[model samples]
Target: MRIMTYNVHVWYDNDGQFKLQEMIDLIKLLKPDLLCLQEITKHGLTEFVKQTGFTKVFKYHSVAILTNIENVEELSPPSNTRNYYPRFATVKVPLGDGKEFFLTCVHLDYKVETNRMKEIKQIKKHLSCLNADAAQVWAGDFNALTLEDYSDVVLNEITSVRRKNNWEMPKNDVSTTMKADGFECSWALVDRPPPVSTCRFDTHIDYIYINQDFRKIFEVTKVEHHGSTASDHSPVIADFKLIQTDDTEEESGDQ
Candidate 1:
């Protein structure tokens, strides 16, 4: 499976140039089976669905998903959380031969670690409702740093900037929290070096994560930053290969 997650930066480039067609061209070249997009406007979404010729498109607020695959089932995020629609969206994609998996696309809080933390807490609550053995993936721009991406000096410098803004220092608890919950970052699992930056900030923040059940069935072939001048944030791609037969055990859990 070829899955991609991209933040279109509101259909503009980092230099403030409008490049919607360029962005479409990039997606055309890659032709991901499943694509999750963030920071897209209503007009941009219409243009993409029309030009890309994707059979299915789902949008909740600014985040949208495009896929050519058939029989894809849309799923809902927890409504109990405040303003959850824009921040989270989900779908169930059939893997054929009666197998399937759940995909939750997300764009977490861009500023304030506390806000991001609250979002993560809600996400954790949502995931806990799913079956323990179900294959699941969450991917998007997290807008938070991972501890592994920076040296102590660079990390401290970032912390200092937040301090000057009267913001609490970043403890990198988001990454740690997800890890503690058994979600594995696909980028870290791959043996390749990541791009210098996934966004204009020169930091790697966008990510793809698969749960233990997913790891049991597929091997991650590659994860890369698909470079583009169309958006401030680069698209992230992950390729997976089926390595083993899926377990057919039936389990009951919330969607």
Candidate 2:
């Protein structure tokens, strides 16, 4: 299976031009089996699906799913909080022949730490409800840099300073989403040749996480940082395979 995670920056390029149609074209070219998009507005989502022939999960929020393969069985919108937009969505897709997969698309809060924490908690709660046992892929613009980055006192201080200045500081931590003990970030687990910058500004924020139990079945075959003018944040692609199957059941597997 091929999957991608991208934060289109609402189809705005680094040059500050809004090219929603160009973004759609890029997604069509990738042709991921499942796609997780962030920063999508209602109009932009409609325009994307219309152009790329992908279906949008029925919801009133930014996160959307675009896939040429698989049938969408369920979609759960992000939990509502007073200060933040619904920037996350979860979908269950049937891979085929009774097999299925779970895809969670998320865009973390870009502002207050309190709000960011709340959003993460909400996301965890929703994922827990899904009973995601089959190959699960959680991807999108996390806004958080990495778990290591959160240890920097300077970064935390910068966040405090931004809060005082009425500027929203981006949360840079992976611990927020690791409520389950065995979850692992795909980029960190695989032996990446080296860190290739993804964002136009040369930052690595977007990511893909899979449950550790599924790691052996899915390998990070390829990961590319598209520096094209499609969107501010480059797209990430991952390939997976089913290595083992429980002989106990064939059709009614968990996803």
Candidate 3:
């Protein structure tokens, strides 16, 4: 399966012009089986969902999950929030042959680290409530960087940037997430360095993460950037292979 995550910056081209056809063309080139987008407008998504090749689509806040297959729906119940758009979404994705995984696509609060952390917790809690054993493929614009992304002293750069921006590093939250079992960034799977910039911010912050239980079940064969000028942030395209049944089920059978 090919999976991708892109922050379309509200579906405008880098020059700040509306680019529905351009965006559509870019997605076609990526040819992702699963795609996640952030910072898109409601009208933009509604239009994209209509024309994009993906047969199933779901959007919440400014985030969207697009898949080539059908039977995609929210993993958790919808919330009645008082915002112009929904802010979070997780979809039950069909992976073929009676298999599936939950893909959570989110555009976290960019202004406050604390707010983003709170939302992340709420998203995880929602997933747990829906299906405690659910496998996850998390992707989005995290809006924060980690100190342990396997880049030497690039670790220091994360802290330095946080200090420069005068935002307190959400240490406890970052540790909790990175330390979670079955949770690994897709970049770490391959030997190449991570993207230099995920968006026009000149920093890399977008990502795709798979939980521990699902990591062994899928193989991330390629992770690379797509369409340099399509959006402010470059879309990350990943080719993955699911080699086995869910580890949880396989283990239960072994016992």
Candidate 4:
């Protein structure tokens, strides 16, 4: 399956132009089987569904999960706290005939690293409560750099920029926390240089991560940035191939 995570910058481009139609067109062109979006509004969601024909959708505030697949089930969010609602959502998606995987999408707190870390923990807690052993994929705008992307040179540049803008210091706590909890970044599996910026900030923040168990089922064949001028952040797309099955390992996959 081709899964994509995109932050629409609230339907505006990097140049601050509202490109609702362009956004819809871009999604059509990409044709992701499972699409997760951040910074999306209600109006945009409605128009996207109408024009793109995504039959199933789950929206929580600005974040949403859109899929055209049938018989997939939407999972319930944790009732303990409403703090993460606006930025997070999840669904149980079918893998094949009788198998399924949990897919969670999130738009973490953008301002502070600590806040983003807290949100990651909340997501992990919620997912653990649902089912810990299920294959899982979590993707969307994390708004914080991963520690692996923070090299000596990149760290210097990022820190200088943040300090000058009076923004909080850059930290990898959010992605690190997720990594510690058993999630593996899809981008990391592909052989590529690090620190490819997803947003205008010149920092790599947007991501797609799958748990180790998911890796056992699907092989990440490709991961790339589907950049579009219509949005500030490029869509991170990952292609997966089913590596093992009860009958035979098959290459059948879709976007």
Candidate 5:
């Protein structure tokens, strides 16, 4: 499966031109099965769906999902009031093998750390309720560059203070959604030269994550920072092979 996460800067490329059609053209060319978009205005989302013939789920402020596959199921929004402004959406897509996985597209608050922390907690709470027996992925712009111990947020609840040695998990690393407990970042697993900065205008943010089970099945074939003329943030593309699993295998394999 090929998935892409892009902060389209509201459809305006780095050239300071606002052309939604150009963005649509790019997406059409890539034909990603799943797309996680940030900073997409309602109008742009509508236009994208109209142009690309892909179904889409649009949150209020900075997150959206577009997919060509059928059977998209929407998950409940986070309960945290801190993020009244929509920042994420959880959607389920069919894997074409009688199996389905949840794909969560997120764009956390960049201005407020307190609010960001609240959002993270809310996301974890929501994940905890998922059918842990199925494959799941959370991908998008986290606005978190450092890789401090998220165990507290995911496991305990202790928040505050920065940890040394926890260089912000690189954008590519965090982008590959991994399980909170035993999963490792895809970028960390493979050795690669420095990533071309995704955020040429500001900061490099945006990501994708897949739990361990899915990782074993699908390898991250590529993670490229598509230089942007359409947004302040560049797009990250990840290609993977849908490792065929025997239907008879344990139902509760990965979540």
Candidate 6:
């Protein structure tokens, strides 16, 4: 499975110019099975679906999902916290073997950390009502930083990314979201290093996470984040191999 998440910087270039084609071309080059896009405008939505010809497209306010896979149904976010604009979208994806997984693409409030925390909590709440028992993946621009982020770029890294000394349950929304029963950061699963920066701000905010149920059945082969002239936020890509059988699992995976 090739999964990607990006915040297209409101579908504009740095000089306040729209570079929709460049963004489209970049996505075409990646050709991910599932794409989670944030900060997309109506124009972007129209252009992407037209160009990609993806079988199903799900829209939740500004965030959108572009996928060629079939059996994708758009779901709703939590109504209780949907007072303001929706920061995320809920989509169910079928695995083709009588299995399905819920994917929640999130782009929390970028301007404030408190608001992001509130929104993330709501996202989890909404997921709880859904069939979380099956595989689940939450991918997008979290905007929430880890404790390792001491730079002023982010709010002292609101969450705990990982334990340096001993294992401790993190209190930040990132940790809370992953600890919600059976989730783990996707980047950590791979032996390769993830891109250092995901956007012009040099902040690695974008991410992809799959639940524990997929750990044994899946292996992340590659993860990369690259800058793009088309948008301020860089593109993030993660390629994975879903091994269903023991013999097929031994096949060499993408590097």
Who wins the lDDT comparison?
4
**Residues 47-119, model 2: lDDT tens digits:** 7888788754544477777776645765646556675566677777675555566778878765555665677
List per-prediction Cα lDDT, in the order shown.
0.82, 0.68, 0.72, 0.83, 0.66, 0.73
Model 3's TM-score against the true structure: 0.81
What digit string (tens of lDDT, one per residue) describes model 4 on residues 91-167? 99876656789888888887898887777777777777656678899999988887566568988988899899999
lDDT score, candidate 1: 0.82
- For TM-score, candidate 3 versus 5, the one ahead is 3
The per-residue C-alpha lDDT of model 6 at residue 191 equals 42
Clashes of each: 0, 1, 6, 1, 17, 0
Tens digits of per-residue lDDT, candidate 5, 7-79, equal 8888887678897888888888888888998888888788888888885564645677877676787776655
lDDT of 5: 0.66
Name the lDDT value of residue 127 in candidate 2. 72
- Model 5 TM-score on a 0 to 1 scale: 0.75
TM-score for every candidate vs. truth? 0.88, 0.77, 0.81, 0.91, 0.75, 0.81
Residue pairs with colliding backbones in model 6 are none
lDDT of 3 by residue, 1-255 (tens): 888898888878778987767888778776788889888888878778777757777766667788867777676645765642336688887665566788888676666667777777777666666455567888888776654543566656666777898966535454356457457778767854645567775555777888765665678888885546768888877788767546656765878
How high a TM-score does candidate 4 get? 0.91
What is the Cα-based lDDT of residue 232 in candidate 4?
87
lDDT of 1 by residue, 1-255 (tens): 899999999999999999899989898999899999989899888888889899898887777778989999887645743555447778888876567888888898887777888888777676676677888888999887887778789888877887897765666888887788788889889854657479876777898888888887778999998778689998999999876542433221211
**What's the true lDDT of residue 194 in model 4?**
41
Worst 10 residues of 3 by lDDT: 170-179
Worst 10 residues of 1 by lDDT: 246-255
Query: Which model is ahead, 2 or 5, in terms of TM-score?
Result: 2
How should the candidates be ordered by lDDT, best one leading?
4, 1, 6, 3, 2, 5
